[model samples]
Target: ITGELINIINSPDTSEDEHLLSVNFIQADTKGPEFKTTYNSTAQAIRIEFSTLELVLHQGVVLR
Candidate 1:
C-alpha cells in the first residue's frame, strides 16, 4: 500500500538511452486520487512534469 510509483519516459525519435528519465516515490492511496505526467517538447529538449492532484471517481485495486 505504501511504496514507490516509478515512471519511465522514452521516445522513438531519440536513439540514446541517456535521453530517458524517470520520477519515483510518488504517493497514492485508495482514499485519494493518482497523479500523472505531461510532456513538453522543443527543438532541443523534452520536459516532463507531474501535477499536484488528480481526481479519480472510483478506487480500484490492481496487482501484477
Candidate 2:
C-alpha cells in the first residue's frame, strides 16, 4: 500500500480528549467493534506502516 492515504480520524472524547473507546467496553448496549464520534474539519495525515522502511512506529503511531 505504497503512497496510500489512510485517514486517521480520532474523535477524542469531548471531556477528557481521549481517543474513541471500544463499543463493547462502553455502555452502548451493543456487542461489536464500533466507534461513534465526530471530528473537526482539520484534515490530519494518513500514515500507516508495518515496518521502519516507510516510517518508524513505537506504539501503532508514526514516530517522526
Candidate 3:
C-alpha cells in the first residue's frame, strides 16, 4: 500500500494530546491473503490518529 500525505493536525489539550494525519492511497496491490488492486474513491483515503507524546519521545520529528 502506498499513499500520499494529505494533511496533519496537531491538537494538545489539558487531558489528551493527539495528532491526526490524512492519507490518500494512490496505489494499492496485494496478493498474499487476498487479491485487490483498486479501491473506491470514498474508501481510498484514511485518517491516521496518533499521540503527540509518542512523537516527542521519538526525538526527531519532521513533517514535509
The global Cα lDDT (0 to 1) of model 3 is 0.39
TM values, all candidates: 0.18, 0.17, 0.19
lDDT of 2 by residue, 1-64 (tens): 3666655543323445332332222233233344233222323324333221233334444544
Error of 1 at 60 (Å): 14
The 0-to-1 C-alpha lDDT of every candidate, in the order given, reads 0.35, 0.35, 0.39
* Model 1 backbone overlap count: 0
Top lDDT: which candidate number? 3
Ranked by TM-score, the better of candidates 2 and 3 is 3
lDDT of 2: 0.35
TM accuracy, model 2: 0.17
Q: Write candidate 3's Cα lDDT for 12-35 as tens digits.
A: 553433234444344333432323
lDDT, model 3, position 39: 47
lDDT of 1 by residue, 6-43 (tens): 33332445445434444444333434332222212212
